[model samples]
Target: MTRCRLCGSEALESVVDLGATPPCESFLAADQLDLPEPAYPLHLRVCTGCWLAQLPPLITPEETFREYAYFSSYSASWVEHARTFVAEAVRRLDLGATARDAFVVEVASNDGYLLKHVVDRGIRCLGIEPSVNVGAAARDAGVPTLTAFLDPATGAAVRAEHGPADLVVANNVYAHIPDVVGFTRGLRALVADDGWVSVEVQHLLTLMAENQYDTIYHEHFQYYTVGSAIRALASGGLALVDVEPLPTHGGSVRLWARPAEAVGGTADGAPPARTTAGARGRVADMLAREKAAGLQELSGYAEFSARVAKVRRDLLRFLVDAADRGATVVGYGAPGKGSTLLNHCGVRPDLLPYTVDRNPYKHGRFTPGTRIPILPPERIAADRPDYVLVLPWNLRTELLAQLSYVHAWGGRLVFPIPELSIVEVKP
Candidate 1:
């Protein structure tokens, strides 16, 4: 983009160029193998003024989320993670099972993975999701989901119908929207004046530190450090109150915010007593860590491109070596990040052969730009390859256990991000 999406600043600096790739989620059908696939530049730029790293809005959300292929409940760990978050939110917010006024709302609530926990507690909850397929799954599971993107108008209408929500939850979706300010305002519109809004997004600090460049894609329009997040929240009339570091999605931050007036003060009283002691200190500490890591300036990003290059080189080398030795190599998951990693490294079906996933929707499809066939998870056990490349390395622990059966056939699992590492599994 010519100017920053967040601050409209022209002082954008190159962070890393991941070359061009098709929208990561656009899996191809067998009938369309010969059809032309469009690709876009997947370069990342950071605005010096705002320090928000972003990709140009090459593709729209409508193209991706309308009939999304991803289903959140497929991953057992993620489902449990959502369960835990729901319980914690309910307790932390003092939401009562029988309280007639208590209500919760989640934006981009995929497949009711988290809201189902809210449903179990007998607390009234609603999920505002954009994907028709996933939203149908949510409703089937008994979560009240509205299939619509969260803009100011939609949020207001939801508020009008359901009344103001006591708690608004947004997880792993803050970076998905191009209109950051408008989305934040939508959060503001849905929440009660004194209610809370919680957002979870991958932290730019951890992404750079761990070489998680594969997470960068067109759908994720922006990345945030706490410093940049605080500024972005202010743009849509929200105040940052707390921040929590999470281990989900490689690394993430849970941001707790409220209406600007709620944090500052109400008209009739001083600021409502909140968790100022712990939250303010944590926010300060995280910001300090970001600055010390040089993320607030250009120094921290200078070597990122070099580091990303090494990952691609190492992975390609491994695949080539395996092919040369007549050893079969395959892939484990067909996640969006996997598409970025595969396309960036120029890995095609000849090297990868095929990848397997538990999601049936993608079983007969191909990865967006890489065209690697996606098969069912059973394919791995049926034709155990010498090595299996684990593309969704962020779920390392869970996947390790899930694929441990490969050990029966002397198979190995390869992880490509944060550095290349091959592990011998124990069945």
Candidate 2:
């Protein structure tokens, strides 16, 4: 655990620490409230060798994802993102002319949010999900799914049963795995020689730059940069082909890869992504930018911890001031990120009352550590609180649009991270 996760180097430096906290997604029911909950050290480190930021495991994945409350379908914007991604992949990958039934595989495919789009296109798809409850939901929706952790062995079994995939989609899962090497190598086994592998993860540069410490939790084991991604995927015999920055999850990057052997790899080692002239130019530019920003050195992380500490004080001050004025403040979205923000700031129901979420799984449960009640989004209008704190600030546009009725009651929206500010909603 002390060694760097990507390069296995002994040269690792501390980045930021959130102290001991419960797993963000570990919400509790009324009966379970009486029981003790576990907490672990929440720290991040950057490898001096590969420059990848990561959190060493204090808990196992078995304990973290045994039962999951997140359902992607609950977010209308996320579903639309999936739908558009499918349509583009279909056209760009030449799946229609190549074969309308191109084989597609998605790892950590939660509730078939993206795979359902593949199904609608008549493309053959399989989901490798570890969550038992969510996997059942995917199955009921007519998507073939397997309940297993993906490694080289299981990935081989998947390709054997269902023909080799034309495209292997791993959206936002690279950061959740502890074995970065094994999981990326598994992509090679699950795909055909000429197939493509796509992985989307929150960019580490954006995380520290934007003060997105809320995204830090036990469920996410690693943070990625373009530099680290190349090393991690290459270790698994895959080569990065292309990279695109995305707006999802505050800021993210979608990486396209292919088997190393297909891109002129030697027996000794695999080459990096096959950069066409333009691709090579862009990759070099990005690496240069990261290096210029001191991302490759330990000094780069020095300012982050102090910035995060100030954020906690600022948010607490803002909320406490609002409560003193006798203004009611309720929350929107009981997201995992909200758990980190609430628990870190020592917020209870007193500072912020109940929150709301569209996911019915979390309706009756309390957020981990902070025992704030969760209600449906309808309550925001019913209560018509003076202020509605938007917890998932990354989706402010979508949340604001959906809860447009809040403006009717003269309710203003508040954002905590990056900075504490009030957003005026317009009809």
Candidate 3:
């Protein structure tokens, strides 16, 4: 029996099965154009004991992130999101005058998107990034970065060199590690006696309720709920004291944690009885709702898969009909989840023609399995396809706003997940 990666519980029930899919980032090479692609089982399961949602094992970090291609700097929205996070974090930590020279460390810091904001305030910062290409981008952006994965040993080295961090930020990367307990322990070791660690991860409850099963790829080893996160941190000598909901990446939670002794003590060395009751209550309610929805049953996922198949059929029918009418259809946003959706629906070059991505590195490459070429977003304006399919449907509002120019040509936008529909642009 497959056991839960977090709590080692054998009580895992299949939540969704996306069938065989290529690796999310395995963009194809030109020379291997005709080579058949390999697909792995894309399945999600929930641990009954800890309430962690995760995919059945496929790839490891060494295989996935060693020379990663995705860069955070490519997305304007993501850059703005990082800036906002830095501002809020600095204010909450009271680092303006008191800790002017305080050190801030970010684990899995992608392309120095967040660190640039912290360093602009004259705060000393370091970024630990495993991807060489992305780490180089961080350095180019004037952020000091170490190209290595964060672990207990690396944490010790960082402390010996840069001193303990006053604040540590890990965004959207908390679920990427296989040894999650060990990773949290490393964060505990690097944090100052009074320092705080903040991590943002996709919310499991939202993933299930919204039928976001496509996000369950091999790179994400564990999906976290606040209850499971608190337990995991407590095991590593840390405590979660606060939670904030963020709208980025479908739905996510920003968790604030610190060493157990750091709580109930002020920066001025006084005891305070502050509590995070509101955040805790919100999280508890979400967990209860998930349990009531039968998240622990295999039948629940079978129904979900059935719905997904219906979406696939409907999308294919629409695309075939559009093609019959000589309507050109192309895809926007070559996101990881977009890859999952494309593969699950058996989309090929004949259906999508090509796709456009904001990331320059992904441009000029072909998507795996489908072999659909990825071009720059500018190509959308130049080509002016009859219908533009927004694969990352969660970002429909943002994408539609950005691509409003299509309206001038009387073009319509299509959303292919959850359902296939042509949406009218609202003024």
Candidate 4:
């Protein structure tokens, strides 16, 4: 029996199956083309005991993140998000004149997209990044980064060197770890008595209710709910004092946690509320709603898979029809969820042609499994494809606004997931 990673519960149920896929960031090299690509079963299961949603075990961190190709500096929206988060954190923490000299550390700090803002204020910031390539990029950007994973041992080492941190920020990387207990313990060890650890992860309740099974890749080991997160933190001697909901990555939750001994505060002192109720209360309502919507029924997921297949058929027809009419169809945003959608839907270069990304590291590389070449976003403006598929559909509004220039050529934007639709731009 597969035990729960958080609560050691064996009462688990298979929720959704994403089929076999390669690691989203495993871009291929030219010489490695002939080698057989490694694919693993990508399935999600929910622990009935603690209500923690997670994927079945297959790959390890060493196998997944040794030389990670993803860099956070690529996304314009993400950079802005980080900058805003730093401003809020500094204000909420009440760090005034000392803010310039206060210590801030980020776990799984991919390329220091957020930490750079902290350093810009003259604050002493440190980044713990496991991927050597990504860590080196952060160092190049003038952010001090340690090339190692955040574990109990590593956390102790960091505390001995840099002392306790006033702020510990980990964004989007919270759900990618397998050892939930160890990871939380490391957070407890590194944080100061009054310091807070902020974690942002995609909310599980939203993923299931919205049919966002494409986010069930191997790298994301766990999907969190407020209840599950609170329990996990308490078990590791940490307290979750506040939470905030964010619209990024479909739907996500940003949690503010401090040592168990620290006193808690009210919602007014926390980040802006994104839901009608507080984070925990909103999560409870969502969980109850999901159960009422038959989330536990396996047939619900079967129907979801059917909807996905229909999307694939409709999108394929559109792309092929466009190509026959002498129009080029390309894709935008090479995100992890986009990789799952592209590979599972069987989209190849013959159909989608190529994809463009803002990340320079991924510009010359090919996506895993599909092997479709990735180019810089400038290629889209130059090539002027008749249709550009926005893979990260949640950011449709943001992406459309940025790529509005496509309307200059009478080109349209296409969205595949949650149904295939061609957007009409208002002149």
Against the unseen true structure, what C-alpha lDDT does each candidate score?
Answer: 0.91, 0.86, 0.80, 0.80
Show the lowest summed lDDT stretch of 10 residues, model 1. Answer: 265-274
User: What is the Cα-based lDDT of residue 158 in candidate 2?
Assistant: 90
> Which one wins by TM-score: 2 or 3?
2
The sequence of per-residue lDDT tens digits that candidate 1 reaches over residues 228-311 is: 888888787777888899999999999998888877722221222455787878877898899899998999999999999999
Query: By lDDT, is 2 or 4 better?
Result: 2
For every model shown, the clashing-pair count is: 0, 1, 0, 0
Identify the runs in model 3 with alpha carbons over 4 angstroms from their true place: 264-274, 288-302
Q: Where does candidate 1 stray beyond 4 Å?
A: 97-100, 265-275
Estimate, for each residue in 25-81, the C-alpha lDDT of model 2 and write its tens digit.
888999998899888888888888888888988877788776788988888888898
Task: Please report the candidate that would top lDDT against the real structure.
Answer: 1
**Per-model TM-score versus the true fold:** 0.97, 0.96, 0.92, 0.89
Between candidates 3 and 4, name the one with more favorable TM-score: 3
The C-alpha stretches of model 4 lying farther than 4 A from their native spots are 99-101, 263-307, 320-326
Give candidates' CA RMSD values in order: 2.6, 1.9, 3.7, 4.1
Task: Identify the candidate with maximal TM-score.
Answer: 1
Q: Give the clash count for model 4.
A: 0
Candidate 2: Cα lDDT at 410: 91
Ranking by TM-score: 1, 2, 3, 4
